[model samples]
Target: MTDLFSSVALPGGFEEVEHTADWAYHIWAPDYVHLFLQAARGLYALLGAEWSPEPGTTRRVKLQGVDYESLLIAWLNELLFYRYGENLGFNQIDITHLAPTCLEATLGGSPITQWSKDIKAATYHNLAITPTDDGVEATIVLDV
Candidate 1:
């Protein structure tokens, strides 16, 4: 299994964080778009999810939230819905539009062939997207 806490090649990346219960990671990217994308990838990593070799599938997503934090949670939870409800795992994500309270994206993936963990939801527990020297970062906690 890939180490959940290993450092990833940068520009945009994620690394696991120690949490007493549930799971958590710190994600960062050069901007909101990449930040969102990295978060999706991080979630999949935590699940140890893998996709099928067949032709990929795609979906369009449009979401709105009260703020960036809520929007982030909604975005991740939407992915979780697809995973458990549809048995899908995405490896391609294109965020065409993003704002303080809304997001639009195209997601591409295939049927999930493997998943080692069950993450119930992406929590808002101490969640916040903040600016950094190069981009933005957030600490995401997932309910397992």
Candidate 2:
């Protein structure tokens, strides 16, 4: 599939990491909003997700967590829900509001036409969002 975030110029990015089992990615961005966006893009890439040609669908998402890690997992799992349960894949995401424990965003995409991998859920194994010289970074592990 095409690179979803190719047109946008953003600081930081994500890369797949070696894992004995399951999947993992190291994601970084200049701030929380960009970090979240990168995480979503990474998740979609990992799924090998593809969208239909039909007009895209849009939905609003709201989530809360006790910390950054939980909030990040919640965000990714929410996207997974749309992918598996709703048969949707999003390429466009706009996070309108974000705080230490809450997030609200608008997601845009179309019905999923292809998915090569099955991701059960985002996991907390060794999950931690940390501050970096440029912004923030985290290594996300997924349950396959």
Per-residue error (Å), model 1, residue 95: 0.6
**Which segments of model 2 are wrong by more than 4 Å?**
1-4
Candidate 2, residues 1-144: lDDT per residue as tens digits?
A: 223567756667999999998899999999998899889989998999877999988999999999888999999999999987899988878889999899988898999889999999999998889999999999999989
TM-score of 1: 0.91
Q: What is each predicted model's overall lDDT from 0 to 1?
A: 0.87, 0.89
Candidate 2 achieves a global lDDT of: 0.89
Backbone clashes, candidate 1: 0
RMSD of 2: 2.4
Model 1 lDDT tens row, 1-144: 112233654358998999998899999999887788888889998999977898978899999999988999999999999999999987877788899889998888889999999999999999889999999999999999
- Model 1 off-target regions past 4 Å? 1-10
